[model samples]
Target: MVRDLTALTTDMSLQEAVRIFSMTRVTGLPVVNDKQQVIGFLSEADVIGAIMPRSRDMSGIFLSDFGEIARKMGQARELSVGDYMTERPVTVTEDINLSTVSETMLMERLKTLPVVRDEKLVGVINRTDVCSKLMEDREAI
Candidate 1:
């Protein structure tokens, strides 16, 4: 489990979110409320989907016109993180077993999950963390 986690609030601009994503080099962030409760989840793909024109693949350069791309990018700056966040995101509890968490993450195709305690944001867990734990267990055995 990663105790040192960075989170974004609803009111933050999409530009700020992008900056955080770049600096942290993470694909997503948990969106928290005033009380530090996880309210939503924001991923890089989500931001890209919001900023770019509709495409079957996010990285696909379907927009042949540069002006449309520029317009979309400018529009993204005006929007807030709340506009692109996925509300009521899937989450996991601190006490959940590693296998269960791994299974859930795989089934949902989630890269990261907010670790909650009493419905409050505490830490975060990702595939890397779970994989590390598995290795540790194997080595110990």
Candidate 2:
């Protein structure tokens, strides 16, 4: 588990979130509430979808004109993370086994998962975490 995690608040502006993403090189971030409970998730794709034109399936077809896309991108600067975050995203408890986490990630197609304990965000698990754990186990074996 990665104890040093970056999280965002629902009221944070999309522009700020984008800056965080760029600085951290993270694809997604957990959105927490006042009590530090995970409430939603923000992804780079979500931000791009808000700015760029795309179908429901997220196919990158160039249907909109440059002016229209530019206008939407500009409008997106004022939007908050809550406006585009995935509410009630898949999460896991800190005590969950690695196998279970791997299975959940595989089944749900998640890249990252927020770790919670007693309904509060504690850490995060990502594909890198899974791989690192597996490598460690292999080394032990």
Candidate 3:
């Protein structure tokens, strides 16, 4: 698990979140409250989904032009992380076994998961971490 994990607050602007995502090179982040309790999860897909026009709402007009995409992004800048974050995101306990963590992530289709201890954020685990650990164990055998 990555102990030096970055987290997002619900009140943070989507633009700020995007900046953090770019700087940290992370595709997703756990959203926490003042108490550091994980409340939601945000991903690049979520951010893009928020800015893109839904098919039903598009009414046949394609947003293919760069100007149209830029306009949507500008509007998204006004939104907060809470507006698009996935509430009550699936999380794993700190003591969970690696196999269980892998299974959960696979079933949920998540690339990363927040690790909690007593319901408070502790760290994060991703698929890479799992693979690395497995490879290390194999080497040790």
TM-score of each: 0.90, 0.89, 0.89
Q: What is the lDDT of residue 65 in candidate 1?
A: 50
**Stretches of candidate 3 exceeding 4 Å from the true structure:** 56-68
Ranking by lDDT: 3, 1, 2
| Model 3 agreement with the true structure over 9-114: per-residue lDDT tens digits | 9999899999999999999999999889999999999998877665534455465754666787887768899989999999988888989988988899999999
Clashing pairs for predicted structure model 1, backbone only? none
| Runs off by more than 4 Å, candidate 1 | 55-60, 63-65
Q: Write the per-residue lDDT of candidate 2 for residues 1-141, one digit (tens) a residue.
A: 889558999889899999998998889999999999999999998898787765534554565556677887787768899999999999899889999999999998888999998878998899999999999999999
lDDT of each structure? 0.88, 0.88, 0.89
Q: After superposition, how far is residue 98 of candidate 3 from its true place, in Å?
A: 0.8
Order of quality (TM-score): 1, 2, 3
Candidate 2 local accuracy as lDDT?
A: 0.88
**What TM-score quantifies how close candidate 1 is to the native fold?**
0.90
lDDT of 1 by residue, 34-134 (tens): 88999999999899878766654656676475567788788777889998999999998888999999899989999999999877899999889999999
